[model samples]
Target: MSHADLLPADVPVQLIDPDGRVTASADALPSPEALLRAHEALVIGRRINDQAYALVRQGRLAVYPSSHGQEACEVAATLVLEQQDWLFPTYRDTVSIVSRGVDPVEVLVLLKGDWHSGYDPVATKVAPQATPLATQLLHAVGVAHAATLRGEDTVVMAMCGDGATSEGDFHEALNFAAVFKAPVVFFVQNNEFAISVPLARQSVAPSLAHKGVGYGVRGQRVDGNDVAALLSVLGAAVEAARSGEGPQLVEAHTYRMQAHTNADDATRYRTDDDVEAWRSRDPLLRSAAYLTAQGLLTDDRVAEMDEKAEQVAAAMRAGLMADVQPDPQELFQHVYAEPTPQLREQAAFLAEELSREDAV
Candidate 1:
């Protein structure tokens, strides 16, 4: 394909406008059933964000990066993958992890300050959520290359924020993946900010997706608030990669509605007007409107989705609220296959302390 062929459209591919009207052709949209499924996931994902925020406030979680307005990107990223396909998520991707068949409580293990990765990567096909920017992209590329070498049909989806694009690792990952023809998709959720830094300060490229052209990777963009459009675009990208089209880069134009985390003061960086504007284009609302227009989302269906989401939130709340009794000695167990002398001594000291406390 020509260089221009690999560039994203002048405007992001938007099927549904903020007003819930169809703005583009329906040819790229997913099936009615898939759209409905995306709508349900959007509902659940939003609830998970809300619950996570509450947990942070209640001191249950050390920190939480809310994907409030970017649920479409999270849900679509996971939905596009097959059971054997892999997902490399960033720290801000708890919603994506939960949507990937992981227990909601387990997904929070990292944020809860209990464990490194809450779920088993081997079983879930999801790498531990990377906190360092763009690091997961390199890991994703390595796994994809390895799968290709092994003749495994495993496609890897490496997700990152807009800020991650600036990192050298991002470029390295893209270049290596393209050169090796690795079946991977680099999905960038361009929520306009890399924490406090706006997209303007990050890179002056026409669009984040345009960065793919330099590495001979195909690029695409989609309206991140429109779940139908996201599902359509991301699904196509994943399949294209799986079919030996090499790596694909997709930039989703969304926004982060909340502060970066509970520790952040959003007002210091952005105004209420800006937050309010994005709220009007909420992904959940947009998905519901489009599904309702299609006659696939009835009032009963909406009610059921809302109820199910509430139950998930309730369970998450209950699970996090329960006090955890961590075994201090267990930390030494995972440090080395054969325990080092230093580790054994530390474990013994901790065990002796616990025994003394029990005797008291």
Candidate 2:
């Protein structure tokens, strides 16, 4: 196929507008049950983001990069994946991790500074959330390639921010996936900023999706705030890859409504007006509106979703409030199958110091 044929549409594929009107044909949309599920997930995901932000403030978490306005992308991405599929998430995709069936409290363990990765990756099929930009993309591609070699029917979804697209690892991952026809989808939540750097400074391409054409990957863009649109678009991408169509790149045009993380002041780089503009397009609001219009989101359903969200938040809070006594010996446990002499010496020294402190 020609490179031009592989390019994403000039405009993003948007099924729902900011006001919650269905502007495009609903024929391609997910089933009513799926739509309702996505809407419910949007509600819960927003609550998760809010609770995580609050935890950062209460000194429970080391830091949190709130995906406050990007719940649509998170929910839809998780919903589109099958149980057999794997997800490779970045540090900002905690909502997606929770949606993928990982214990919400365990999902925050890395952010809480408790463990390398709180959950078992082999059981969960989710790699530990990568804090470094674009690193997880390569890992996702490796898993996809290995699955292909083993003749296993596995599709991998790799999540990253717009800033990660600027990293060399992102380029290499796409190139290698394209060359090998790996069954993986690169989901870019282009929230406009990579920390403080805006998307405009990152690439001159019309859209981040366009970069896929260079590596023979099919590219598509969708309104990231529109959960309906994301479900349709991401669903298609995942299915295409699963059916041996090769790697796909999806660029979701969303915005980061909060600071990059708790440590940074968003006011330094963006104006309040900028954030307010996207607030109207809040994923949860639009998803609720759409579902209500469809009669799938009744008052009772809304109350139920809210109650569920509160329960999740309460559980997360309680989990974080509990004190964790980490074993210092765990540092050396996973280093190697057989400890090296240096590692053994360090472990012994740490043990001696701890005993000495106890005796004192």
Compared with the true structure, all predictions reach lDDT values of: 0.91, 0.92
Leading candidate by lDDT: 2
Query: Candidate 1 lDDT, tens digit per residue, 1-360?
Result: 787789788888888888788887777677888888888888999999998988988999999999999999999999989999999999899889888989889889788998668789999999998989999999999999999999999999999999999999999999999999999999999998888999999999899999999999999988999888888889999999999989999999999999998999989888999989888899888878877887889989989999999999999999888998887777887788899999988889989999999999
lDDT of 2 by residue, 1-360 (tens): 676769899899998898888898778777889988888888889999999999989999999988899989998888899988999999989999999989889999889998678998999999999999999999999999999999999999999999999899999999999999999999999999998999889999989999998899999999999988999999999999999999999999999998899999989899999888888988888888888888888999999999999999999999997998889999999889999999999999999999999999
Ten contiguous residues with the weakest lDDT in model 1 = 21-30
Worst 10 residues of 2 by lDDT: 23-32
Q: Which regions of candidate 1 deviate over 4 angstroms?
A: none
The C-alpha stretches of model 2 lying farther than 4 A from their native spots are: none
